[model samples]
Target: MIQAKAPGKLYIAGEYAVTEPGYKSVLIAVDRFVTATIEDTDTECGSIHSKALHKDQVSFVRKEDKIVISDIDHAKQLKYITQAIEVFEQYVNSKNITLRHFNITIDSDLDDASGQKYGLGSSAAVLVSVLKALNEFYHMQLSNLYIYKLAVIANMKLQSLSSCGDIAVSVYTGWLVYSTFDHEWVKEQIITSTVDEVLIKNWPGLHIEPLQAPEHMKVLIGWTGSPASSHHLVSEVKRLKSDPNIFGHFLKSSQLNVEKLIQAFKTNHIEGVLDSIRKNREVIQYLDAFATVDIETPDLKKLCAIGEKYDGASKTSGAGGGDCGITIVKNDLNRENIYNEWSKNNIKPLRFSIYHGQ
Candidate 1:
């Protein structure tokens, strides 16, 4: 069996700010995942299959003499798998490896145990798994860095809201000080000690909700049901960055937000992280027409109402049309009660736990 898995991710900082050149966002890899398994079939053709219960997406295959697979019907799924395959084909063609039939299955632990949240980089996780599978099956010596860039090509292929941070975090799991300006990849430290050490005495990887208490922290992830697209607005934001005034304001705001989050992590102050996310949202909106420049969805308002009562901070997570939102818990909030309440409202609260890379 050719097996592969990719960790889901979330933006910790610089939500819509990643569209610009000098801006950098932060992302974390979660324990939960989306995996793909491909088994070689002796026959000349194989099929693509997905979880039975998941009417969520269609299962398909682009059959040929040798197995060629793609599930591009869902526009939002991105073209990570297809792109990875295309890239891998280049190397495989060099070796003249004859194609073989195979059966490919994609299953996400996200839907099974963790309720799939569009906000957490579920799409990215799936794409990464495809790339890893290709590397394994084709004997391609692709490194994590190459995998990252290849994924970026696929990310921006259909979506322009990439900050390059999500894929980055998915690859190099753990705490990091990321920036697109002065420090591109500084303080690339891993916070997953399993046994809290240095900077963090009780470092717990990312944790999901309605589950065991995290060793380090617990964050609340919310969905907007409808979110304004971040791609267009982010691209517009990049154009504005060309203006001196807009550029300065945008850069300064992002820097300030990062500093605030840093302080929160430094003192293990949940409130600090909450406040920073709240503040960052304002800055993103300040870009006017670049972030949430359109109609605000009720989901945003509803989740905010529920999250405000909990703790830390609550804000929209990604390409923010009305998809999903996230909140960091602060004090002694009742995790169970709120999670149940959210579910009653058709809102799925996920238990997100971070992962550490070896």
Candidate 2:
């Protein structure tokens, strides 16, 4: 039996800029996690048990050649993990010894976190953990970096677009500066880190004080109830960036901020980290029109109203046509007050940090 776990992340800065390196995005591993456990046996077939979601009942799992969920409108949308499974089968087939008889279990706390409901790269965590476990289960000799790449390929299968940042940080286990545009540099920095120290070092999450919501902080998250189409949104943005002038400046600003954050992280300066976060927020807002759109809902409007009283800023979390709204309250005596106010209004505040994928 093999068991593995991966943590979820909260993007502290550059939420939208991640799709295109406009704002250097950072992810941190949070307390919440998504895990996979596998029990190998001599049985004839492989089966999957999804303990988190109880909606599906199947006698068997879908084959790679079968209807991949990535193709269907939505079938768990776990194509990243499924795709990795496909590649693993190919490798296993060449070896001939069947390890098919297995009971796979997956569990997650990626949804409605702290009552904040929306997807935030939960699939990325699942892909990372499963790839590592499967690699070990099959006795495939692959380095952590190599296995991480396999998960990134799985992500590509999902949307044909993937940034190695999410999964890389998940497997790397530390505070890191990652960029998909510069995969070589990202890998270099991550590989250079002593993983043993990062995992065992006692850390203070107390530095995660709430930021003041700038008055300009006009934010909202409109839930379509039906999931928004990330593929369509990604494609539209790609087309817009065809104008070199617009994207050139965008990329340049992002790359610069990334360097500043890297220096701050190296020095272990909390104030510097927060300063960089504030600056990057502006970079993300101006990167593109899709960064913040008209899909923000009325409930989101109410939350903003509450945060306004606290004197801070807010924005949507992901691809942002509509999903979860993230509110940052600047230093104030009323930070907790504002958080409590939102809760009274049925909004469960999420304590998110950039250090979440460890």
Task: Choose the strongest candidate by lDDT.
Answer: 1
The lDDT values for all models are 0.58, 0.55
Lowest lDDT 10-residue stretch of candidate 1: 202-211
* TM-scores of the models, in the order given: 0.69, 0.69
Candidate 2 lDDT (Cα, whole model)?
0.55
Residue 91, candidate 1: alpha-carbon lDDT: 42
Q: Across residues 147-230, which tens digit of lDDT does each residue of candidate 1 receive? A: 665565455444544555666666666655444321122112221221112123211222111112223466667554443455
Residue 131's lDDT in candidate 1: 71
Residue-level lDDT tens digits of model 2 in 205-225: 101122322232222222323
